[model samples]
Target: MPPVEEETVVFRSRFNRILAAVFWVVCAAALVAIGLTYAYRPTGSVAGLAVGSVLIGVAVLVVLWRPQLTVSDDAIVVRNVLSTIVVPWNALIHVDTKYALTLITPQRKVAVWCAPAPGATAALRASRAQGTQARAWTAASDLRPGDLAGTESGRAAFLVRSRWNTLREQGRIELGTAGDQRVQVQPHVASIAGLVAGVVAVALVTILL
Candidate 1:
């Protein structure tokens, strides 16, 4: 038996990660400010505000920092806002980036939230900044904005498609396996529950104030 060699890649929105980093700094400062304010003049409203602010900040961080996709030779783990999708390469039928980086399988279509298709303005900027070049895995027009190699969705889709094509050509993906396999989709129940709780706490604090 031979060891499985792996080359894993993780992708996230650069803008979102930067925003999360900035928000984390703001949260740290807010905590310090709240602590100082509480020490100086202990008040119930101040306590309420602190609690609400913490809850709100944490909820915001989860939204900003958590969405990502991890790719390996075997599968792709897509961590969306509300759910996660595990897509094995054998189960994939095609890749599409109409709205986002999407995986089409026999069972369903799964969208990768982190790799959203660039809007017209963003796409135009990308095209001008880096020429609208067609990726190696695709023969579509260079002007196909969503399929252009410069955009986020296009980049992710290219990785997925390239890997799939390699496996297909090498005969690693079994012919009948697609019908037998299903991609796993799981909801982020705990995260969702905590977010809901935070929202309720914020609402209660707001009402009290």
Candidate 2:
């Protein structure tokens, strides 16, 4: 028998790119404003420039460069701002979307940082108009109409469930040993700590001056 080809699916928010672009624009505007202000009054305190730098840094870290979820043949990779988590398909009991995309295992539930569900109003609207948007909804037995067609998190979950089902049907999913069952979460402590320290330092300087 021929081996089944594995497909890798990536789920990301459509808004992330737009928001990142906006962040960059805001950062550039801030820099230009600071430059013009400094040019007009050379004697002005450097606090303005410092403030602009902090703003840009925060925006870049928090909004512009956010996390994304990738579902591969072997595992689901969650790339967060300060952490990365890889959960094998065998380890994942199910995928859930309430406020965000969550990977459920027997031991724990891990939430994805990038994909967030729609707000209450939007969700209600989505529920009411579920069947009308068949084109947007991906076909998956594990996925709800509100989820697969309604929100970013839903769509991500659908893709994940679809792939999982395929693998299971092909007898590719296997029960692993204790070590393999554990979720792999790697945190970028240095980057997160540095950002926090920088923010605190800026705050202290702003207050002291």
Candidate 3:
């Protein structure tokens, strides 16, 4: 037998915790200022003032502290507010999407608790450089989460599916469901949109109130 090609690389979803934190901080500060200004205003009601202040504070904390997802060459990791889980590819038996991507493994099925995975992060990075086909594997965007289940190198494929399932639950999970057995992971704009809308609402209320 001749030499075999192989593609081995680890990939991770981006973390928005810092951005979330900053957003919350700014909102909180603005809300506090507004609350204080209105607290003593002759035209403001005590109930309205109190409600706005409390809601602003709580929203800041909650929005700023959501979960995150981590990926690697052999596993899909989910880090939530209170826990972290690492799922191996082999354990992932089925991967489906609905309200979110659901991962069914031999052990059990669990929701992913992290930010959505970006489209082709690994493939984009990999393509930027030139290397062997690494087992003659095609571009990742051309592979589906289920197709890998039947392969000898299905480990990585399994992880990708698990990650997709996890993301599906979060919101609109974008995957290129094209070709015979190919699934393309696409960037999800809804996650960012939600975050922005939430921040803007809080900020505007804080500043204008």
Candidate 4:
């Protein structure tokens, strides 16, 4: 059975999904073209190339679709490409978006891959678009590009910060108690292994030719 989200705020980049869809369509078209070429004049080289291309395409698609961030009452679940990190609200110390929208826990800092900060070009354009995300944060007066309401990082950080603030105000989250709560990091070993195998298959086919 597939996992389902119930009473959770799940955030994923629509751009990533659309891009992966476009790439999959292209891959499908390429596969059709490969089949036609094989029918016209079948060759081992053609088969190998087709196989390699398919593997490479699949690997790329996985990368596009992997990252997401989910927020529930108790925790923020960050699903990056290689691993998933679960940070409970009680254990969270601060939220930063210097590079990416990150959760600053006592033990380690976890960056949200899907919510990467805007680069220089974007930052330059963001001055006119700044909002109140930084109002409660450390650098309340000075805003980074990622702290702007229009950015990916800012949007994600808002969800986290909003809930965290509510918890703090309600007296549910205590200060200096971060070490008492446990943060879990789960590596996506199967996904990693599958991607590695796919790359190896593609490389072997390309190299043999």
| lDDT of the structure predicted as candidate 3 | 0.46
TM-score of each: 0.82, 0.80, 0.37, 0.83
Q: Residue 108 lDDT in model 4? A: 91
Deviation in Å, model 4, residue 62 alpha carbon: 2.6
RMSD, model 1, all Cα superposed?
3.4
Write candidate 2's Cα lDDT for 35-148 as tens digits: 777677753244646564756657566644667889888788998778888898888887788777888987778888788777877666765666644534434344443364
Off by over 4 Å in 3: 1-14, 39-50, 53-57, 63-92, 95-102, 106-109, 119-209
* Candidate 3 local lDDT, 89-202, one digit each (tens): 445556543223445565556555332322444334443333445323544445432233222123333556555555555433334331122222333345555545666665
Clashes of 2: 0
Residues 160-207, model 1: lDDT tens digits: 877777767777778878767878989999999988998787677756
The model with the greater lDDT, 2 or 4, is 4
Q: What 10-residue stretch in candidate 1 is worst by lDDT?
A: 134-143
The CA lDDT of each predicted structure is 0.79, 0.73, 0.46, 0.79
Q: What TM-score does candidate 1 get on C-alpha atoms?
A: 0.82
The CA-based lDDT of model 2 is what?
Answer: 0.73
Model 2 ranges off by over 4 Å: 42-58, 62-64, 125-146, 175-180, 204-209
